[model samples]
Target: MFRRIKITLSLLLTLSLLLIYLPQSLPIAGAAAAGQASQIDAVLVVDVSNSMNTSDTDKIGNEAMKMFIDMLSTKGDKVGIVAYTDKVQREKALLEIQSPSDKEDLKKFIDGLDRGPYTDTAVGITEAMKVLQHGADPNHEPMIVLLADGNNDFAKNSGRTQSQSDKEMAQAVQEAKDAGIPIYTIGLNADGKLNKQALEDLANETGGKSFSTNTADDLPQILSEIFASHLKLKVVPIQSMTGNGKFQEVTINVPNASVLEANISIMSSKPVETVLVDPTGTEVAVPSDNVLLSKSKSYSLIKLLTPAEGDWKLKVKGASKDKIDINLVFNYDLELAIDPIPSKTYKTGDKIDIRASLTSNGQQLPNTELYTNMNAVLVVKDLDSSKTEEIKLTNTGDSFEGSYTIADKHEYELTVRAEEKSFYRETEPVTVSAKGTTSSSGSAGVTTPKPADVEKEDAKPFPVMLTIIWGLIIATLLGAAILIMKMIQKANKGFVGQLVIEIRDENTNEKTFPQYKKLGAFKGKFNLHQLLQLAPELKETEGFIFIPGSNDRIIIRSQNGGTLEKSGRAVDISKGLELKSGDRITVPLSQADKTIFLEYLV
Candidate 1:
């Protein structure tokens, strides 16, 4: 009987999990077999920064993209162009590739494009996303294929932090992920100075892949990989289970799945911990190498290329206190791949070779046409010396090659011009810093602190109302002190009597002892806590003791030399202080204690 019950319980658990599947109650493979998916819309976001123009990344990228478009048999598929520098410029609006002729317009758009001043990648991504909404096939899922050669230089131009740039990118990626869109990023060269890791991180967070190439000639092959394998995926939506308070748990059931990609976002500002549990009931490790930490571990995005099919559970903590939860689910996504790797970085004295990678949207141009269709010019400038020179670079193949010597120990700006188009990269501008030179300034030698601030004009006077109020307060106090001293000298204060204090209930008309208090909350209690409220000076004691002087005059002095008043007038009681019968004594309380009251045996 015990064995049967255990078996029954196990069966019930499995049955409960079966309900975790999508509302359709069918597997993804089964859905795909049903033939429901349609065209996938893609946005081509190009970096029109100076670096792309100078390094020929823009030219190579254009040829590579046009070749990829030619290879794609996307009959009804739509593609849009998003070119950006400091802002987004939608060159060719979202257009469908109805026939082979539409490819030429796109090629022309890429060929005629020019470089912009700064790199606003986040702005480009955001604007590109909006472009996907117009004239888009409702059945298609949108994707952004972004290519960047350098880091976002908008920080220096806009006078904001790189963190703001990072946050903006993260937010845009999150928005894409929420809309079931994936972002595939291609980085030309992000060697810390260019922020290549940020591109990789954004890709990871969005369940997308990051590609990189050092040279411009090999960029077209990267573009080819994105178009060659157009994997069509069906969107699966499962019933969501809600959890609360720190560690919220949710399960994503990917039945008969080959690839699993997910984005987990905490609906909170505070950082949270997101852990994944496989179908085998074992917790998956947070791979430090694969994770992209944005804004200091605030975003948790994980991508699983080959996931085990079972009940994949997502566990999140940190948002429980705020009633915030994590949004985690499997989204259909893909990434671009780079080929022919190991692109080199050229220095000041090193010669850089630019070759025959130029192509319009139609065909790849040959190296011989470089002289007629394009001419390369290299301009170098030393900021410290304010010296500059322009030299004609020689074309190697479909590219140009040039070399220069570092003669000045100052920052430099290297620009490339081809066919009346000038290209400039925002990354380390002509970074040929002189050896053995040190300064208390930031990289780029732009921001430096001053030794002294410039002097300003003298401060003006206070307001008239403020000046009059302060003057009256000082004069009144001085006048009262003089009057008190004069009266003390003339009055006779030699009378004697025993000092006594009479206590009466202000509301009840009944006399009470010193320890009595109206402790309504703790009524019928004669506790020392009540006595402390009456005479706080006897803070640690339960009672007070006083002795009368031989003379009837009573003197009260403050230990801290604080001011005291009688009948709203200042008193010089510190010098031979005296009091009389029926004289009510009221002592002001310190900031930390309540006011006290006494009577001279009236």
Candidate 2:
């Protein structure tokens, strides 16, 4: 019995020794076996706009590139370079650096960068996405670093406008957001002020972060920090228990955490505890007080937990100072509905019938009041005169119906604004044409035809009389056709006679034409040549002629002191003379004589 007890004690001592030593040894062994999987696939999108030529911008670019290279060197990660201005140029993969040995080549690429005339951020982002999607592993976390020194410059080119560029950039950002790709934006110089808000919006939408750098020197550190703090993990519960039950062994699988520290939180009625277990079935005690996460490597582990369940929530919060709020919900289902009918088409003066119904789980909700506001108005406009009238809507029962008068013939736009509780809904504009009637004259005149006089005595027509009546009708039709042709010819003549004149600067040769309609009048100085051009009749006179339409009528003094007098009525020639380049004319009224400067003489 003594020997047996001694043997049992020896075995127990051996087991405890194994438990303590194996736990620490197994983790090291497993870590070695898993190898280093913290490979960062990053794309650098640089803005080469002219504004980047500023001292601050250059510093930012240089620093950002340097920081990126240093981070890659430490982690042996893959990095691609995309330089963008009006267009995007991607560095060849062979030229890119994925290891420390390729740092020289990467430095060369960064140093060779030149500023472009315009900035096209959208194009840059799109190209970056293409590079990341095609070049990087889909299973890996992909990040894009976009640097810009100007507003969306892609728009100001000779071919495109600013508004168009904004739209394209917005679309590119949205696409990146949809793809679950994070974008880190660095705005340099004034570019930050111009596009900071937009960059923040993109970052918020795409689960990324944005920073502004006044100088290029700040870029490298910022980028280094960004890459050094990246993390990606896939969280899943091994077993789930609902409504008050102890969950047995909830495991979380972490895939990567190169630049981030992750904390796994298991919420239950009781505070849950976490234990790191190795493959050898030995418990590893983690430093419960504090842990330092690595910047150049990733750690993966399976978390085990046992918790009493009553609507339990498991969350993994990224541990980084600049970390954005990433809310991940599991196993969710959603239903959407619109109050009133989802769609309708109505004409002006017609009542728009709207009914409420909710579409959920393939069923229509009828009991819900779906309370909606009825103060929305539909504005109908006469397309010709642009006359518009607003019609208010009111709900009757479950349907809201309202009528508006069809004031004129037009394609009426029916817009419905409905608010159900806190949700707001708007229907797309529905186009309905207002019926229009034509008169006999066919000049866009709407008039009803009068009934024939029934009290007039009926006269019997002879065959010759009937023939004569038919001939007159044919003659009238022929005359109408001739009249139409003449009118068309006159219109063509008028159009051909109209002239456009451009006045050019004598020194700079810059030309400008006065928009008489906008200014109503012109102001400036004139010369002899301008005066002569304004009054061509002065050419007949030696050197000069009288200034027409001047309040103080001044005689045009010739070199010989001879005053040139008007030979004919100036009004006739004035009416025929079309304004052209360098013309100096004036408008004279009896009440108030106003001198007008004519930039154009035709």
| Alpha-carbon RMSD, each predicted model | 35.0, 33.0
Q: Please estimate how well model 1 matches the true structure, expressed as its whole-model Cα lDDT.
A: 0.51
Residues 1-602 of candidate 2 have per-residue lDDT tens digits of: 99657645555554454465455545443323222234567777887767666635334465456445543423235566778777764342212343344655566667777666776777777777766654454435578877774476544336877777778878877878877778887767544454678777767778888887665544544554465445322222244333222223434332211112233322222233334433344544543322211111111121222211122233233332211211111211112222333233323454444333223232443433443332345555556666677666665534445655554546566555543322333444455555544332343544545445333323444579888996776566556546655644533331101112234444464655442211111112112333222222222322322222232122223342322113222333322233333344432222222122333322
TM-score, cand. 1 = 0.33
State every prediction's TM-score relative to the real structure.
0.33, 0.33
Clashes of 2: 19
**Alpha-carbon error at 188 in model 1, in Å?**
0.9
Model 1 root mean square deviation, Cα atoms = 35.0
Residue-level error in angstroms, candidate 1, position 500: 99
Question: Which portions of model 2 show Cα errors greater than 4 Å?
Answer: 1-36, 55-57, 73-76, 89-98, 154-157, 190-193, 232-602
- The 10-residue segment with the lowest total lDDT in model 2: 325-334
